[model samples]
Target: MFLGIDIGTSSVKAVVVDGTQRLIAAASTPLAVSRPHELWSEQHPDDWWAAVEGTVAELRAAAGRSWAAIGAVGLSGQMHGAVLIDGAGRPLRPAILHNDGRAFGEAEELNRRLPAIGQIAGVPAMPGFAAPKLLWLAHHEPEVLRQARHLLLPKDYVRLRMSGSLATDMSDASGALLLDCARRQWSPEIAAACGIDLSLLPPVLEGSAVAGELTAPVAAAWGLKPGTILATGAGDAAAGAIAAGAVNEGDAFISLGTAAQYFVARESYRPAPEHLVHSFCHGLPQRWFQMAALLNGAGALAWAAELLGKSDIGAMLAAAETAFTGPSPLMFLPYLTGERTPHNNAHARGVLFGLTPASGAEQVTQAVVEGVALALADCQAYVAETGALPEQIAVNGGGARSPFWMKILASALGKTLHVQEESGAGPAFGAARLARLALTGEDPAKVCTKPRIAAEIRPDPALADAYGGKLVQFRNLYRAVKPFYQ
Candidate 1:
């Protein structure tokens, strides 16, 4: 059996897989994130450690006979969160998460320090990325920076606890903004510019390489053999890509999480200035990926539900099932949490317009859900602008569980939506598969499949025509609201 662990913003998930890459058993536990100050999302490294141990034990219980045979481990986690550690590897402070915006000002300073930052990163210097978060600590929390000997991201932290190694995978390192993504190595120039010592960073390893092994202490405590191989895992999204079964080019998945991104695997790294989609190295060498992010999806839907909804989720979906928008002059901009990809605006916010007293909850709810879907369509259009249209899209997440969201997204994209029938699994299992590949040099293409469609929703010409018009309105909202963001 092989083990894969995913450390996410909300939880840590662990999965045990056999040599065939078949998932044997999986387990997860919540890892609460704390925001002590505005715009700063943090989680205790101890909490993550507890989660890793707990989830692994749960996986052992679930995996049964295979537990004693496990030979490898890997991890996937939330990208860009900074985990600072002392000499003996104790966490210096709570981890700074990917969603934290407390470093926006430092991001600007870091931006001016690099000449071709945009060209190098394929995305603008944003406060959410790791380098900016590190700078935030340097400027304000110098004590933490001074005492901290090494920095690791979410998954790497878990890897360190398991392997007694300081390492990271290329997929997760790409989010640090310190990597020369095309070359798949750290940039010394960026290190100098950011004023962070290069040694403080972990070495970049490939996603599938054997990272380290479980030491005796961790082994005994977790009921595993010592020296079990640990593979440098991937980021949650990349792992999700594997889990979603998009192992080759032309296949991709749209994730509607606290944030959202559209990803397609590629054979090479080719930057697109027009679409501004992120061009980064893939988990597989000689391959690359392009992703467009929406910054908000389920997050927006959840916010709408909280404000305009009272009933349970099923009842709410039932109440808001019907749609009427383009012809009605109602529109929504689902930017409640800023945006990435095409537009790198951090000051943006979501809006709902064209409300009437008669404009009941259905209209607003449909507008929000459809607006988010259309915004995703906007990402596909960006890909279309770049000349690569995915023949199929795999939709997954909290949003994918909603049939209403799936049907609307299918209609808006004019593509078939393939759903995975797996029970409550996402990026973590994906991380395990990638780790399996990383360790055994296996081809993930052979193992994964988009689950049989529990049901397929064909696009109605009428709905498509209406959404086409609203999509135009949707794109313009960002441009029109530029001054507001500035």
Candidate 2:
């Protein structure tokens, strides 16, 4: 059996996959994000380790003998989080997450000061990227900067705890804004511009490569053999792509997790910064992908559910689906934590418009779902503008479990979406595949095949015109309210 661990924004998930690629057992532990200030989002490094340990124990119990037979391990995690570490390998503070918007000004300053950074780093500097957060720290917390001995992404921090290693995969490092993505190495120019030293970053490697081995102490505590190979894992998005077998050129998938992304695999590095499409390294060597990322997806629905006093999002979505007529009269902007792709507006806030006396839970719920779909529609357009849109897209993530939301999203984007079996497994399953590769030295092409298709969702012709009009209104509303965000 092979093991895969995904350190997600809201949880840590671990899965055991047998040699046949069957999921033997899976476990997860929930995590919380701390938003002490309006635009800040953080999680203590200790919380991540705790969650990983909790899930590992659960997986061991569930899998029994399979746990002892584990051959290799792979990791997948939320990308772009800045975790500063001291010389003794202790975190200086809470990790700044990818959704945090506290460094917007720093991001803008970096872009203004270095125009070539976008081309070099794959995506333009954004508040959510790691380097800008470092700049924010340099200006606000110089003491922390002075004492920082190393910088690691969220998963790398977990890797350090697992194997006493300080290394990162190319796919994850690409998002840090300190990497020369095309060259697959750290860019000294970019690092220096952000007041970072070259030595602060971890060594970059392919996600499938064996980066380290489990330390004896951790292996003993976790009931695994010492020196078990640890594969340099991927960013969650790249790992999800590996799960869907979307590694070849033109293969595509849409991830609708806490954050969403419209992704297309590419054969080579093709930066399209002008269109705001993210071009980054793939988990596999000699591969790259373009993505349009959204900071909210199911998260938007979660927030709406909380506000409407609905404890079960599935039940709420069911009610909304049952009451669905045409497009919702009300409009919602799912920018609860600002946005990433296309707009890059960190100050944007969520909005609900066209509310009336009749607008209750159903209306609000439907609008929130449709709002996320419309935001994805913008993503689709911008990605298409760069000539990378695929004909059939695979859908995955927690949100994709809702058929109603899938239908709404399909209509909004006007594309056929294939819902694969085990789609909800997402990145953890992919990480397991990477683990298999590391153990057997198998060809990734053979190991990372697409799962069986469970269903296909296409656009509803009857609701096409209504959705088209609503999409227009959605764009218009954002423009009208842009000044308010500033």
Candidate 3:
């Protein structure tokens, strides 16, 4: 058996996979985000560990003796989070998450100061990336920055607690904006610009490599064997791609998790910063992926559900689907937490235009769904600008559970969307596959084959044409509001 863990922004998930790649047991624990100030998103590093413990305990209870058969562990997690640590390897403060937009000014300054960062780092400096967050710390909290001894991504921090090691994978490290992505190494120029030394970063390794062994104390407490190997793992997006068997060139997928991504595997390093697409190293060696990443996805739906006093998101989507006719009467901009890819604007805010006295919850819900779809359409267009678009696209994550939203997305993009079995378990399942690859020395292609498709959603011609018109308005609306945002 192999253990796969994913430290998501909203939860920590763990899964147990047997020798035949069957998911025998799985569990998850919810997490909370602290937003003490506007545009700030953070979480205590210890909370993640506690959540991991919770999930592991549940899995152990469910899997029984199979837990002891675990050969290796692999991790997948939300990327670009900045977790600063002191010399004692203790967190200095709460980690600033990928969606935190407080460092927009710093990000802009970074781009201005180092014009080559866009080409070298695979994407232009963005507030969500680690380097800009560190820059923010340098200017606003210099004392903390001065005292910090190490910086780790979210999953790497979790790995440290499990294995007492400081290391990271190239796929995760690439999002930090401090890596020479094409070279798969830390960039001294970028580090200097962020007021951080190369020593502050961890040694980068491939995702499938053994990063460290489970420490004896942690192993004993977690009811695991001593010296269990921990694979380097990957960022959530890369891990999801691995699960979808989207590692080969031209393979593509759309992830609709807390945050969303439109990803395409690339054969080599091809920076497409001009299109605002991320060109980063894939989990597998000698491969890279181009992505148009969004800061909001099912999270937008959850927020809307809470706002509308709807406790059941499924019910909300059902209501919205029933009310949907053509395009929504109201247009919603789904930038509640700002946006990336194409726009790259951290100041953008969500707006519901054309709402009237008669508009109700269902209309608003439909508009929100349309808003997210339109945003993803923008992502598809920009990703298309980089290279030839993939003919087949896999859809996964929390939002993919809603066939209504999948239909909306299919029509909006005018393409078929494949929903595979266990789509919601993507990252954790991919992590398990990586663990298997590390333990058995198997070919990743064999171990990471795509799961069986559960459904295929094809575009509706009438809705597609209507969405095409709405997509034009969506783009125009963002440009019109851009000047007003600071």
Model 3, residue 308: displacement in angstroms?
Answer: 0.6
Error of 1 at 149 (Å): 1.7
Task: Name the candidate, 1 or 3, with the larger lDDT value.
Answer: 3
Please state the error at residue 160 of candidate 2 in Å: 0.4
lDDT of 2: 0.91
**lDDT, candidate 1, 206-282, per-residue tens:** 88777888889999988888777887878877777777876677678887766777888777666674566776666
Model 1 clash number: 1
lDDT of 2 by residue, 152-175 (tens): 999899999999998999899998
Which segments of model 2 are wrong by more than 4 Å? none
- Model 3 over residues 278-342: C-alpha lDDT tens digits? 99999988889999999988899989998999999999999888887878899999999999887
Q: List the residue pairs that clash in candidate 1.
A: 208-438
TM-scores for all predictions: 0.90, 0.99, 0.98
Ranking by TM-score: 2, 3, 1
Provide the global lDDT of candidate 1 against the true structure: 0.76
- Return whichever of 1 and 2 wins on TM-score: 2
Model 1, poorest ten-residue lDDT window?
321-330
